[model samples]
Target: MATRFSSFVRCILYIYSFSTFLCLHAHEARETTESYHLHHTHTVQVSSLIPSSTCTASTKGPKREASLTVIHKYGPCFQSNKDQLLVLNHTELLLQDQSRVNSIHSMFSNNSDGNKLRESQATTISAKSGLPIGDGNYVVTVSLGTPKTNQTLAFDTGSDLTWAQCKPCAGQCYKQVDPIFDPSKSTSYTNISCPTPLCTQLTSTTGSPRQCSNSKCVYRVDYGDGSFTTGYFSKERLTIISDAVDNFIFGCGQDNEGLFNGIAGLLGLGRGQVSLVKQTAQKYSQFFSYCLPSTTSSTGYLTLGKDSEISSSLKFTPMLTLSQRQSFYGLNLTGISVGGQRLSIPTSVFSTAGTIIDSGTVITRLPPTAYNALRTTFRQMMRNYPMISSSDPLFDTCYDLSKSQSVSIPNISFFFGGGVSLDLNKVGILYVLGQTEACLAFAGNTDPRNITIFGNEQQKGLEVVYDVVGERIGFRPGGCS
Candidate 1:
């Protein structure tokens, strides 16, 4: 009887153990399925992907001291004669963008030898401008010279020297919508003399040693596409809207040629001492914010000073200072998430090459490791949609959603340092080629070590704030209405 009781107890214990094991396994399976669903699934309607035909005005934040309207060069909002518009196709625009990127990479490569020049300390001032020019760039208009000749100039954060084509055209000048700025006519125009501290500063700013032209400091800037601008380094009165700064250093190009799209010249917003950001650091406190419109047809604004109201909404990440490339803004990108699921990309993949945020680059370039994981996951999530072939090598994942009124897409978000996650707007996700065709806006770099670029396309509808004094970059969504 005791043996029978012992056998029965043993059987009962065995049954309970087996039952518990099955339960635990079932719970784990359920948890695994839930985790997969959470990460791999995001469904956005197709109609939300299309951009509006009319211009969407950007919403104003707190009252900024100085603000300028930002316009797309090819958009209808930019008022210029037909001759002034140098419209480029998508392919041409991408090519120009690649050229800009190549120039940046080359600059870094050339300067990596640790023999980089140091920027000189000099008294600086502030200025502003307006207007839109170029195929993929945004432009602003600013008044230059004593009498306040209003000139439309393209503003570029990648470049450091504010330049405009001057009257002489000693080498040659390209056609511009505004009259060629005649420096001789302005009372405030003064050529920077060679051997001056400001002249020496040009070596660090332009990456080329300063040249003397009749005792005046001469500057030459060469773009990657063989476009060159050479002329006198001078100072003049620069007015952005109502704010005016005297003795504002700028380039008076006697010889200029490039695909400038009939704009007067460029406004340098780089971090260098000669850049507008550094020069105006006192007044603006080294603070600036800009919103790139979703479509070229839309209008956006660039504010020089901080907008106190929008401060709380912004997500900030530390701004890194690369010794080799001080002019460009650097940031650490940790990971990417698709459909709310963080990709399986290793953090080392992004850390190896480093990354920079650029205003002039049209398309964002990602490292191959990150790009492949993103593409694969994105394709799996979008398997329901029909795939289309693209002739452009830059964009491979194209989709044909012409027939579907409401297709689904995965949402993408970028994770940066400081635990900041930026969710891109619908406009930032895909490049719409036509009614039927759209392609992923991101591309993989040819070389993994090539620096990753966060281009302006992904910045659409976001208030990108650069606080140089604080050493942080901030992003606030829904900046554009």
Candidate 2:
């Protein structure tokens, strides 16, 4: 009887130990997960969704800096003929965005050794013109040439060559608010000759073979959306807010066609040898920062030089430069937190395909695994709100809040390498289609191997600093203010 009692006591002890283990596991989970409250986000009003007539004040920065006002191409602040602006629906916008993404992927997949340089040859000036501008691009005004003619151009971090439609459009030129640049009028304009080192760089810059048009180096850039620009590779003076950069290599397109939306041309802020950033490296030290306004009606600032006060408030992360793609700026996205809870996504999921921060892409793209976790968690937290259907295939998670006077959203943050945690602004979390058709601003890539993109939508209201010399990218909150 004593032996039987001892066995029974051993069985009771085993059950007690198992129960204790279960309780500890549950407690640990609870500790790791955090809850969110509505007070963490700003209340978004439906009336504010409409674009305001007057432009909001530009983000204040240091005086004497090479700062340019950034205006959304579709916003009211962009003064242009109403007919020039094409009203693209959400579906059309996503289509154009996908086109740009596809082009980037193609560029990465088709990486190859550039063409060999040819023998030295003279340059012949030719009259040519081309179209410019992309959907959802931002425009900035700058002076060009000896007389310094004001020209509004779209700024792109994804492109390398800076080009504008030059005068004497013997071939084809699209309509633009500013008169096409006349090289004859500017004494400073000079065509780049063939076989020159600067001209050979176009092979890598445009991803096209070097061509000489009547002894002049010819450049042809084909965008993903079927937009093409072919023009003489030339040099001219580029002025940005009183800072004049002489001998700036740019494209004087003679043949161009695209939906430029009345913009003169493109300003390449990419990380290539021929990009504006590299051309002005001596003056700016390869340092530049831009703040995208939260709303279309608001104004933002793009500064070329670093500001001491702004630099102090920034949180930095290591910038990655992949061998296959050198012009694009890369970043390591470690994890994401929705409603204050960090999703249980593996680091390998993000590291496999890699990530890039693009000023052109509108919506952020995530790996399927990471996106699924984020979407599921976001849906659970937003369960109280009514779910709505969206016609746009890109946006799947949408909520209807027409009845509510104010929106109380859960806080979302992104954790990057080097312990950098960035809390997104309220505008970044939800993309308001209307009062009733609000949706999460993120989307999932079809394949996990596809590279992730951190789009400009999430970058609104924050100052994004690209320090090429330091090899780091920094983010500061409330930069648009």
lDDT of 2 by residue, 88-143 (tens): 35676677888777766555544343211111111211111111125536788998
Report the lDDT tens digits of candidate 1 across residue range 1-481. 9999999999999999999999999999999977776554444566666655445555564345488888777666566634445653678777888887777666565545432222211222121121111333788888998888988887787777788999888888887778889888999999989877768766445655566878999887777777777898888999888888888888898888777757888988877777888777777888898888777778788889774554688999987755566667778899999888889899988877788888888889998999999889888888888899975677899999887886656778999889999988767778876667878899988878777889999998888998777778899888874
The candidate maximizing TM-score is 2
Flag regions of model 2 displaced more than 4 Å.
1-39, 81-88, 109-133, 308-310
Poorest stretch of ten by lDDT in candidate 2: 120-129
The whole-model C-alpha lDDT of candidate 2 against the native structure comes to: 0.77
TM-scores of all candidate predictions against the true structure: 0.84, 0.85
Quantify how close model 2 is to the true structure by its C-alpha RMSD in Å.
8.4
Clashes of 2: 5
